[model samples]
Target: SPQDLTVSLIPVSGLKAGKNAPSAKIAKLVVNSTTLKEFGVRGISNNVVDSTGTAWRVAGKNTGKEIGVGLSSDSLRRSDSTEKWNGVNWMTFNSNDTLDIVLTGPAQNVTADTYPITLDVVGYQP
Candidate 1:
């Protein structure tokens, strides 16, 4: 059975993620975005974007360099494949980071629908 728990807004949407995510102690972010209506397209392009239509770009905190590119749900799932990605050699996100996922492209079947992006916090570090 699914548990019903209320998700508090991360200081309301449309705001910038200046430093970190609002959630307490959550260091890693496992963002799972799913469309309410099926796009039917197997390999459509998707990314995390902001309210201003700008794709949210992530980078290393210390180095201030752009991080690895986004990965698909399937690609992110395959340990063998995901580990091969060269851009980002780590799996972690800073606290209070505001991120949103979006799917686009692949010609047709890319239906215009709402995609609910769910965040799964990992390694609670207070």
Candidate 2:
């Protein structure tokens, strides 16, 4: 393409939350993309790390391959299951606790170049 267009699904293999993270789950999401339809989220899961640096991947609400852990997007909730969105929420942890996050989705206007996307996770404390 002369305009330089690259389409790809942004894969969030893992995201780790630190002990200072709030307990509340995902309260909101902010996405920046060139096309709405071109962007879609999926497979948002988490893993908590203990003081020993051990990680325990939380099971997904859905009982299927990779289904157990993922973003639990709105479409997935309405069409697939009735479970809450907690399936992709960031959980609280003890001292030195770290969260391992994994989020995968489609992206538009991708190009054959090095691009970096940063995910900033914030939640309410309760």
Candidate 3:
């Protein structure tokens, strides 16, 4: 039987608009007895919608205006292109490992508010 995997992220603070936010550490990834040979992680922007079902706009641009995600490890770093996942190489890991993830915002013209985001983890087996 394969064991379950656990992933967690540390709470981030002081994320300002219109700039590259501070990197957030994916504190832990407990890959137990799973048969997965490799794994990859990426982030996606969860744009908010209004009552009329219209996606929220940031200063005249889509919620994803200049939002981008970057994932980095001790050996490699990859960034998504403007809110889209371009697929990263599979990373082999042991029991516990950590990865640094960062989000970049528009260089200018942004408002102060919370922007929802999602992190997707994909695993592969041999």
Tell me how candidate 3 scores on lDDT: 0.39
Which runs of model 1 end up more than 4 angstroms from their true locations?
1-90, 104-108, 112-116
lDDT of each: 0.27, 0.27, 0.39
Candidate 2 CA-lDDT value? 0.27
Candidates 1 and 3 compared by TM-score, better number: 3
lDDT of model number 1? 0.27
**11-45 in candidate 2: lDDT tens per residue?**
44333332212222222233332322122222322
Assess every candidate by TM-score: 0.23, 0.20, 0.46
lDDT (tens digit, per residue) of candidate 3 on 3-103: 45566665355555543434433122333334554445444334422221111222224443433334433423321212212433333443344555443
For candidate 2, the per-residue lDDT at 117 reads: 25
Q: lDDT rank, highest first?
A: 3, 2, 1
Model 1: per-residue lDDT, tens digit, 32-94?
222111110111114334221222334334445432122233323332211112332223322
Error of 3 at 70 (Å): 1.7
